[model samples]
Target: MARAKTTYVCQACGAVTPRWQGRCESCGEWNTIVEEIVDSGVGAGPKSAVAGGRPVALVPLAGETETAARVTSGIKELDRVTGGGFVMGSALLVGGDPGIGKSTLLLQAAAALAEGGRRVVYVSGEEAVAQVRLRAQRLGLGDRDVLLASETNVEIILATLQNGPAPDLVIIDSIQTLWTDRVDSAPGTVTQVRTSAQALTRFAKKSGAAVVLVGHVTKDGQIAGPRVVEHMVDAVLYFEGDASHTFRILRGVKNRYGATDEIGVFEMSTLGLREVDNPSALFLDQRDRDAAGSAVFAGMEGTRPVLCEIQALVAPSPLGTPRRAVVGWETSRLSMVLAVLETRCGVRIGANDIYLNVAGGLKINEPAADLAVAAALISSLTGSPLPADAVYFGEISLAGGVRPVVHAPLRLREAGKLGFKSAVTGRLASSDQGGDLAITEYSELAALIGQIAAGGKKQAAE
Candidate 1:
């Protein structure tokens, strides 16, 4: 009898090593290395079981292709995040933190699809069938005709799917709890996750049924599995929201059939997730127009324009190192903005404890928010309240120059729709300045800083 070979694998990045180590050389994560048996016989070619396989036909690139069919769930927000609807024969991986409403959202989608007269199967590996029913009843979806099952064995699940009439959509509650008999490792191990995902992906492709796999996320907000699983799926959607907030954002990080970086906003309520048709209004509902250190930012997410508030506080620091606390925005980007203000604009912000936050728990990633953040920071430093009806957006370069960004018209239109009268932004082309709002163009950051400081002094004298 031959002995089985073993190798150490990093659970974070799937880097395999021959010997055990304290930290992973690939991802620099500590204590993520685990020993697993290596199956040498896996993927080996069959010797005499059958004759040689036939060759596959190849087609030209210019051939006519039909549009992929999609199944529309009645939930418009869910369908929007899924590129209008769930594509047939596609595998989507939805990941989020625990209790972040991954299961709830999927259940709602499944119920909607079933109500539309489509066959839907929801197999749960993490919870019992009774628990799922209880949740459905709580959400008022108990009357839906969605089929439910509770099992984690991959082989049995595949067999059950094969033995019944082909369903239009299949949902796996979670991939971590699933285990395959072929792999000797535990359920959540890297090998098992990869193998199970591959099997489900193959099944979806062959049966022409859309499959959704729920994945658990790590403490750092990444999906808890091998990175290969993400690559194997046709789409990847992340459910994001702060626990303290009622708003939730479903963002598509990767999509083959739709636009990437697209988001669908939902408001969590006692009934279920309610789609927010106008997320801008929801984000700006509690704005304090009279407060200093607060600026409304007109930004773009995918093709949609959004307006949100940026709040900044510049207080005298009591410690040797001033604290820089930020939420819902990148910390390094904040540092870069501060550096530009200090170096080029001659702002003495280093002595203050700077705290920045994006109201409504929405994360803003566009560089266009640079001008808004800078405006808020300067307003806090000078105790000057920005114009109550003005919005801010523009990218600030390292040289303290305000650069123009894309979709200026869209941003201005959204601001104007929200009753904002004026916008402070980079110099715009004549064609992009046809909006109803007043535009104040600045080529450099120093000019805006000077204007705000002068306004503050004038207000104090009065």
Candidate 2:
């Protein structure tokens, strides 16, 4: 008999190496390479797959199909993030940092689903049943009847799940602890995670039960397992928040059944995670409109219109390289905006030590926020407060032009609903309808800069 082969895989990037190395060449992550046997599991050759499985008949694309059934969790935010409700027989992977309320949010959702007459099973591999019970009791969910188990073996879990009728929803707390007898690799390894995820996902598809898999995030805030695990699932939702803040965001990065880039807002409280009906209002809480360098960004998350505060502070830097700090927004985007202001608009904003923040800890990804960030920076540099009742949304080009963004009418409607009086944005497209709010349209970044500086001077004169 031929001996099995072994290979080293980088836990960070899932790159296979011939031998052990101190640093991963693919990802540059140090000490992440681990040895694993490749005789079976996902790393096995094509013969392993074709040797045992029988060929099935291929079906045509034209066929009768039933609409997907949804089970609502009774949590507005959770449902919104899941595109109305959880689709039956779907598999979802939720990833977040430790102590970032991933477990808490799932516990709450399970309880809510149970209350709504859905058979929900919560299998925890990271904590005991008693620990889960304590959290449930604290969240006032002790009265609800939720099936709970503490197990890590994938075979055992699948067996237990099969014994009873297929459940409506099954949640596995932390997929890293799951191990399979088929894989020689230890738990939390790349092969084990991938194999276990494949097993659970296969069960979900065959059993007509929705499965929620919780994943652990690495130091870089990415899910620790192989990227294939994310691809296998039907949806991937990320729970993001700061420990210092009460607000947590559930953003959908990949959804086969729903829209991508959708976000649901939640607030942590003594009882449990409370759904925020009006996220814009909660995000804009305690508005200090009189302060300089504060701008309200009219943004869109999927189809939902959102408004958030963008703040910037510019100060003299003694170091030759001015320090640039950014939070809740991309650092590269900030650098681009700064360069545009300097090279194109002639704003000369590169010499100061700049700090930018998107209040409420909600990260902005769209380029529409560029104009708002620029407004905040210019306002801070000139010590001028923008209009308190105004919201801004536009994309700034490298050639100093302010480009119009999609959903302009939606952004304005949301801002007006929140009592905003005006909006400063790019020229509205013919298809983009206008709202009742006053619109301040701009064509160029330099034109906007001149207006803001002139506004500061006029305010000073008054």
lDDT of 1 at 110: 93
> What are the per-residue Cα lDDT tens digits for candidate 1 across 174-257?
999998887778779888888899999999999999999999999899999789999999999999999999889998999999
Candidate 1 TM-score, C-alpha based: 0.97
Where model 2 places Cα greater than 4 Å from the true spot, the runs are: 47-64
How do the predictions measure up, each by TM-score? 0.97, 0.97
lDDT of each: 0.92, 0.93
Query: Which candidate comes out best when scored by lDDT?
Result: 2
Q: After superposition, how far is residue 374 of candidate 1 from its true place, in Å?
A: 0.3
